[model samples]
Target: MNAKFMITPVVFSMLLLASCGGSYSSNSSDSTNSYGSNNNSYGSTANDSNKNDMRSDSKPMILTQKDVLETVKSKINSDIVVMLPKDIPLSSDSHFLSAKTTDAPDAYQVIFYETKNPISVNSDDLKEASKATAIATVSGKSYMTEQEAADATGHMDNVNTGMNGVDLGSNITGYTDAGAGSTFLNWAEGRWSMSVRNTTSADQQDSIDLAKKVVAMLEKETLPAPHQVGGMKLEAMPNKADGNIISWQNDKTDYTVSNFKDPLDGVKITTSFTK
Candidate 1:
């Protein structure tokens, strides 16, 4: 993506936030937009970077953190990373987007959605349309000249832009049912996501804001009460050793690389891969 298009992941995620349906035309003025980042001791939840349209991406796809990061490295440039489900496009037509995932790991199974709900605009047309006016006031050529904007509705593809969403809080943990409620207070310990799409600006903002609240909760979210429950030794793979490759083709899960984190250091990059 270009620097002008370098909005935050929250924006894309928020785009498909709810069932928000903005009716953009083919003659809106140019718009400008900016933004940050987060993550986890995560178990690859569809890297749900911001998408447009209220798509359902809370499902656990067969993806790992390493696979996503590597894809970003190989395919995208060095600006920022906006991960989405393979169903949504990389455009400004809708409110949400999702990443692309495969059904059997190796096969290419993807879905992209182009929202019919843009306030419509032209690049050459410099009309005065702010994000706030997109809902009710903004319309076709009222915001821009005919030549100012192009049919930018097709900018995005390969993301699930029509999925649904719910909510999050400190109580939710792991992956739970989408219909449980809007706010899954017990989803997980780190950051959490709901299976519902937030389509409106307020809804998207709420989602992002809720994420922040969870991060705040992370500092205070209670850990499992210390008991006789079994636990594994807590250790980070060396930051400089070959990353452990957990995949299907290999007999074992880990195929450590030659340049993994330092052997003696207290960090490592454990990668989850497909067979």
Candidate 2:
């Protein structure tokens, strides 16, 4: 008997985003939002109480971009492509918070925080910096055979057929729900499955238009080549607060460009990685 592994890289990517402090609030102005809010109390000394509240025993080790990349690369043996933007937008003070890797399924993650304070990649302070502005992740497991991959792909096609709406070029399928104020686009390209999700828009056409823009942007880049192609799934919602997420998967690796506050930022990040 052969062992079978079922990997949901897209969902795993979402969980990683949440664990790293990605915000799902529709109200971008909310100071309490998870990812982009600058109201965190770190590095603040406005009052005596805050000064005393600072951790005295330890300080998070600040890391440069190169350091984080090296740390992540050192741990994983898989030749996975790590996608990241040339520059993180919104704040000049942003810094790398952590680089993590996991086995069994083989995964890696890199988090970028928009903060003025120094936070170690593996410290409690990193968790407190939940308003992380950006995150990039790759994860996946090997399939037993081509039949398994085909079955997974066929199942996904059947599952997502109902939500299909707009037709993005290059076989990309777009689904827009005006009532729910959400849009989801999905496709398979070059041994990879890709998707973009936005829950903040209400107009169906607006959502479709944005999906088109993202698809167009992805067309100009060179995507990672995996060992095999697998199944794809599509899901959407309107007025949801999950922000924007762009996720993709190859035969044995899953990639994500996420935690961005704006939909266009997601596009920028995706294109940057592929470029």
Cα lDDT tens digits for candidate 2, 23-108: 55445447665444455545443554455566554575577755764665566555444444444343455544453455443445
lDDT (10s digit) by residue, model 1, range 1-275: 67647777658877865424443422222222111112433332234444422245544333333353345334332222222221211235334222222232212222221222222222111133332121101001111322222121111122212333324343332221223223211122221111212223224444445344434543543322211111111112223122311111111111111222222111111111111
Off by over 4 Å in 1: 1-63, 79-275
Structural similarity to truth (TM-score) of each candidate: 0.14, 0.48
Task: Report backbone clashes per prediction.
Answer: 98, 7
lDDT accuracy of residue 172 in candidate 1: 38
lDDT of each: 0.25, 0.49
Candidate 2, after superposition: displacement of residue 68 in Å?
1.8
Q: Worst 10-residue stretch by lDDT in candidate 2?
A: 232-241
* Collision pairs in model 2: 35-131, 139-254, 153-231, 180-238, 181-238, 181-239, 182-238
